[model samples]
Target: MTIKPHALKKGDQIALVSPASRPHSAEALARAEAVVEKMGFKPIIAKHALSINGYLAGTDEERAQDIMDAFSSDSISGIFCLEGGFGSIKTLSHLDFSQIKKHPKIIMGSHENTCLLTAISNQASMVVFHGPNICSVDRVESIAEIKSTLASSTILPPVTPSLGSFPAGFHHTSYPGNAQGTLIGGNLNAIASLMGTKYSAHFNNKIIFFCERDERNDIIERWFTSFYLAGHLKRIAGIAFGEFPDCGPKDSLSMKSYQDILTERMIEHKIPSTFNMPIGDSSLSRVMPIGIKAKLDATNGKLEFTESALD
Candidate 1:
């Protein structure tokens, strides 16, 4: 009963919505508009996409309304979040998932926006995109990946570890095995924050959970231990974590040396897992759909999509 959105077409009108925070700068937003245009789509800024209220882009209600407007619009075929900082969770209460389930459209973002993606997938039963935010996407490959995914009749490319730029502690075989399941996760901290809430992402029914974060190793362990105690580790079909943080302190680079503790837990649980895949803010990140079925070839350190996220 998954709700897949219609494939996007060239010249399809789309919106650039700021659900979390305002763009880093007006220049960055303009560049983002150019990138979307280069993909052959006409982009419009949402009504409140530029309003800023302290750290938030605007009030929670404003952000939620823009998203609702995008979903309810007939002309707009997709949405791209301006950037991820904080405040997406606040908008959840304002959204009407039942209304959204009837008018599914492609919505893409990453970082703190993961909560929105998770909620849409869980409540609306719709597929969502975890990808580079509007202000951060500056490359031809990244553009191609997102554009190609929303279009019809193409199997997204597989992520072969050998072809990716691996970061510290992020290798293909933290635990040797393979498993196939729905791709379900985004920023590790965002996912963790939703754990006790109504929007928590599913961990049961076999899932290839993927995550990325920019926190220190000790914090990672605390969160990882919490997940383990909650029985999440026992339910995952496989797991992959992206290493580098897009905006983190310098100490994150030293996190590589403290990997053994989590690695041991992976081995002990016997779950198929891989570390440091080029996901999240990594330069080599691919457009990973939130609810699609994929094969995690952990033994060989590869990820292959087995099902499309679009109808």
Candidate 2:
């Protein structure tokens, strides 16, 4: 399916809706607004972006309406999820997929937002981004990725490598080979959530899967087991793992334990894998296009931009 690019213009209105976590203070919202305003686009908040109901931003019905309203509004050019925590999957069936498909717009977020972005793209055939959220990390690289993706006249190379230059806090590796395919993946838990669902992204020939999860101790083992058992990881040409945002220092297991779990899981499938490719809760994050074709070099441990993320 060909996706129409929803590129941003000078005065484009970007709707900020909370499809997930809603436990936000007034100060946090102000900061988010400031971040959006700094980018020069009008950031309009959904009425329930700050509503909190336990762990959810709002009721599934209310969140779904906010998303549907954004896409249905003629004045809005894009939908930017305010933040991701959980609950995106709960609101799925309530969304108007047909209306969103007819008036396609850029939908962007990461973490748990992965569920919504991937599901909508696969079901509606729209190009939703796996980039940073408004209240999420908006580093220089992340902003640049967003700008390039939403701009016209941008051309991506046929094959790209993950940018080299590891800082002291991070580690890297080399895959030594490359494969090309439509990029499809997000949070590991999110991908796992799509099992038995019609909205799951179809893994076809030569697809490169990028995934990450919150770094919870011993959880990686179960997550990867369920993910592979779901047949989501077996068909991909390559894999890239972003920072596990849920990893906490309180956990008894060391960082190496988490890495070992990932390695073991990939080795179980005998597929080449790359880890520590950056995207996470850190202030520094790179925004990767969700559905665009790109090269994953496990030898050099890099994911390069190959084509423009949008049509």
Candidate 3:
């Protein structure tokens, strides 16, 4: 059964923990705290929220302990990652899935947090969010929408086509069909890294959405094909490709676009898929719910949630 966490209310305490990398500076943390306060929520910084050990927010054990403490604390109504970098995977083994299952509070983040979100959904059976972290939270233009998503349990309406030119290499493929399944996926690199591990996502009969950044075409192709070869792509109801900033081909000789490669793979699997979604590393990025029942209409380029991600 899917566990829906209680919706946020005004003055609810949100624990800000750094499960991945540390913020760029102390100012970044202060800015995030200000933004949270402006949104009418209390921001409680975790013990390791500002600590830095190389590129990570802190040691693996320290980061994991912050997450554990956040979930176990009765005062915290939600948990949000400080930033997404390179250490979340290291903290997985130290996490207490049972504590998360028992608390059942909203946990939200993206990028490196993808690993944690997927694991929590699978292991704790809780609804988690895939969206901007503390750094991106204040940068997002739709702060009100984000607040609503955290506070409301109402089913989302159909997503309208975004008004903007598609990114270079994006294709508006016309696959006329619709499919419904639980939403699962995040950063392509992070998701692929979890392959064969206990935290790897079970894409069977699910709507898988992924995006990448700063990766060469060759590397992207290998990862995309890895999913196909592993039989994960074949069983998915549909696929949604998100913004891939700076993910162009490294060599000019390669004529195949990233979209072309992805399209080919989707065709081979005979799965309905759409590209150029405004999720991931886009300025117009919208918040998406992980582990919620959603409908993907590839024909019209729309994704609708059949149920709310939170209670």
Candidate maximizing TM-score? 3
The RMSD of every model to the true structure, in order and in angstroms, is 2.6, 3.0, 2.2
Q: Cα RMSD (Å) between model 3 and the true structure?
A: 2.2
lDDT (C-alpha) at residue 242 in model 1? 63
Alpha-carbon lDDT, every model: 0.81, 0.71, 0.83
Candidate 3 lDDT tens digits, 1-311:
99999999999999999999998999999988887877789999999999989999889999999999999999999998879888898899999998789999999888888988888989899998877786766544646656877888888555534565445334464354788999988899889888999888999999888888887877888888889889887689988888788888876456688888888887777788788776773445667888888898887778898998888
TM-score of model 2 (CA atoms): 0.87
Q: How far is candidate 2 from the true structure (C-alpha RMSD, Å)?
A: 3.0
Measured on C-alpha atoms, candidate 1 has an lDDT of 0.81
- Quote the lDDT for 116 in model 3: 87
TM of each candidate vs. truth:
0.92, 0.87, 0.94
| Per-residue accuracy of model 1 over 94-201 as CA lDDT, tens digit each | 999999998999999998899899999899999898888878887788888788877854557776643546343246578888888888888777788788888988
- The ten-residue window of minimal lDDT in model 2 covers 156-165
Residue 230 lDDT, candidate 3, scale 0-100: 96
Q: Where's the lowest-lDDT run of ten residues in candidate 3?
A: 165-174
Candidate 1: stretches off by over 4 Å: 162-170, 246-258
